[model samples]
Target: MSASYAIADCLTMLGRNLKRLRRYPSLTVMLLAVPIVFLLLFVYVFGETLGAGLGDAGRAGYLRYVLPGIVLMTVASGAQGTAIAVATDLTQGIIARFRTMAIFRPAILTGHVVGAVLQTMLIVVAVVAVAVLIGFRSGASVWEWLAATGLVALTAFAMTWLSVAMGLVSKTVEGASNLPLPLVFLPFLGSGFVPTGSMPTALRWFAEYQPFTPIMETLRGLLLGTAIGHHGAGAVAWCLALSALGYAWARRSFNRERS
Candidate 1:
C-alpha cells in the first residue's frame, strides 16, 4: 500500500477509536480517577511525613516530589483501558470485518495505539493541572515543560503499544484488563513515592535499576530542575526498547490466522 493510503486508513481507524472513547465516558472517568485519587491521598495523607524525610517544605515539597510519578502512573493506568478496547474489537468480529475491507491491515492496530496515546496525553494534562492546583509547583521553563511533555508522550506511546500486544493475545476482555495492572503499580516499587535510598538494600537496588525509576527521575529533573545525569539517556533507551518489543509482538499476534 502507498504511504498516503495507509495514513488515510490509519486516520479512519483512529477516528473510530476516538469515537468509542467519547461514546463510553465511564472508562475514561475510571481510568482518570485512579491517578487523581492516588495523587490526593499521597500528598495530603503522606506528604508531611515524606517531606520531613526529604527535609523540604511539608506538603508542598511532597507534592512536587510525587507529581512526576503520578504523571507516569497516569500513563500506565491508561493501559488497562487500551487493552480492554483492543480486546473488545478483536473478540467482536470487527477485525474480521476490517480484514475483508480494502483498508491497510495495520491501521486497525495503529488506530488503537494512536488513540490511546492521545487519550493518555489528555489525562496527563489534566493530572498536571490538578497537581498545580494542589500546590505542586515546578521550576521548569517553557523549554523544560515542553521536553517533559515530549518524554511523557513517548512513555505513553511505548506503554500503549505494550498494552495493545497484551490485548491481542488475551482470550477474554477481562484478561486484557488485568494484564496491565503491573504497569500501573510499578511506580510504587520504584522511586515514585519515596526515595529509593530509604528502602531496604534489595528493593533499593531494584527501584534504582528499573525502567520506571529512570523515567521518573528524568521527569523530576526536567520539571523540578533536579539532576538528570544519566537518567535522560536511560529513559529514552527504555522507551525505545519497549516500543520495539511491543510493536513486534503486537504485529505478530495480530497477523496470525485466527482459529
Candidate 2:
C-alpha cells in the first residue's frame, strides 16, 4: 500500500478497536480502577510509613518520589488488557478473517498498538488527576512536562508491542493475561517503591540495572526536578530496544500462526 493508504487503513482498524472498547465500558473501567486503587492505597496507606524512612522528606516527599513509578505501573497494568484483547481476537478467528482480507497486514497490529496507547494514555491522565486530588505535586516546567509525556508515550508503545507479542504466542486469553503480569510487577523490583540503595547488595545491583529503574528515575527527575543523570538516555535506549524486539517477535509469531 502507499504511505497514505497504509495510514488510512491503520486508522480505520484503530476505530474498530476503539468501538469495541466503547461497547465494553465496564472492562475499560475495571482496567483503569486497579491503578487508581493502587495509587490511593500507596499514597494514603503506605505513604507515611514509607516516607518516614526517607528522614526529613516525610510521607509528602514519598508521594513525589513514587508518583512516577506508579504512573509507569499503571501503563504496565494496562498492557495486560492489550494482550488479552489480542488473544481474544485470535481465538475468535478475527485475526484470521483480517488476514484473508485485502487490507495491509501490518495495519492490524498497528491498530491494536495505537488504540491501546490511546486508551492507556487516558488511564494515565485519570490516574494523574487522582494523584493531584490526593496532594501529588510536580515542579516540572513545560519542557520537562512535555519530555515526561513523551517518555510515558514511548513506554506505552513499547509495552503494547510486547503485550501484542505475548498475546500472539499465547494459547488462550487466560494465558495472554497471565503473561504480562510480570510487566506490572517489574517496577517493584526496581526503584519504584523505594530507593535501591536501601536494598541488599545483589538486589540493589539488579534493581539499579533493570529497565524499569532507569525509566522510573528519568520520570522522577523530569516530574520532581530531581537529577536525571544518565537515566534519561538509559530509558530511551531500553524503550527503543524493547520496541524493536517486540515488534519483530509479534510480526513473526503472527505470520507463523496465520500460516
Candidate 3:
C-alpha cells in the first residue's frame, strides 16, 4: 500500500476500535478503576504512616510523592484491556477476514495500540484530576506539564505495543488478560509506593534499576521540582527500546499467523 493509503487504513481502523470502546465502555471503566482505587487506597490508608518516612512531608507530601507512581500504574493497567481486545479480535475470525481485505494488515494492530493509548491517557487525566482534588499539588509550569503529558503518553504507547504482542501470542482471551499482569504490578516493584531507599537491600537495588523507577523519578522531577538526575535519559531509552521490541514481536507474530 502507498503511505497515504496505509495512513487512511490506520485511521479507519482506529475509528472502528474507538467506536467499539464506546459501545462497550466496561473495559475502559475497568482499566480506569484499578489505578484510581489503588491511588485512593494507598493515599488514604497508608499515607500517614508512609508519609512519615519522607521526613516532615506527611500525608499531603506523600500524595505528591506517590501521584507519579499512581499515574504510571494507570498506564500499566491499560495493558490487560488492550490484550483482551486484541485476543478477542484474533479469536473471533476478524483477523482472518481482514487478511483477505485490501487494507494494510498492520493497521489493525496500530489501531489497537493507538486506541489503548488514548484510553490510557484519558484514565490518567481523570486520575490526576482526582489527585488534585485530594490535595496532590504540583508547582510544575506549563512546559513541565506538557513534558509530563508527553512522557506519560510515550510510556502508555510502549506498554500498549507490548500488550499487543502478548495478545497476538495468547491462545485465549483469559490467557491474554492474565499475561500482562506483570506490567500492572511492576510499578509497585519499583518506586511507585515507596522510595527505593526504604526497600531491603536486594529489593532496593532491583527497584532502583527497574524501568518504572526512572520513569517515576523523572515524573516527580517534572511535577514536584525534584531532581531528575539521569532518569530523563533512562526513561526515554527504556520507552524507545520497549516500543521497538514490542512492535517487532507483534508484527512477526501477526505475519506468522497470516502464513
Q: List the residue pairs that clash in candidate 1.
A: none
Superposition TM-score, candidate 3 onto the true structure? 0.98
- Per-residue CA lDDT of candidate 1, range 1-259, in tens? 9999999999999999999999999999998898999999999999999989998668898999998899889999898899999999989989889999998989999999999999999999999999989877887899999999999999999999999999999989999999999998889999999999999999999999988999999999999998999999999999999999999989889888343
Error of 3 at 152 (Å): 0.4
Error of 2 at 126 (Å): 0.6
Estimate every model's Cα lDDT from 0 to 1: 0.92, 0.92, 0.93
Candidate 1 local distance difference test against the native = 0.92
Q: Where's the lowest-lDDT run of ten residues in candidate 1?
A: 250-259
> Per-residue CA lDDT of candidate 3, range 228-254, in tens?
999999999999999999999999999
lDDT for 35 (candidate 3) = 82
User: Measured by C-alpha RMSD in angstroms, how accurate is candidate 1?
Assistant: 1.0
Candidate 3 residue pairs that clash: none
- Sort the candidates on lDDT, descending order: 3, 1, 2
Error at 210, model 3, angstroms: 1.0
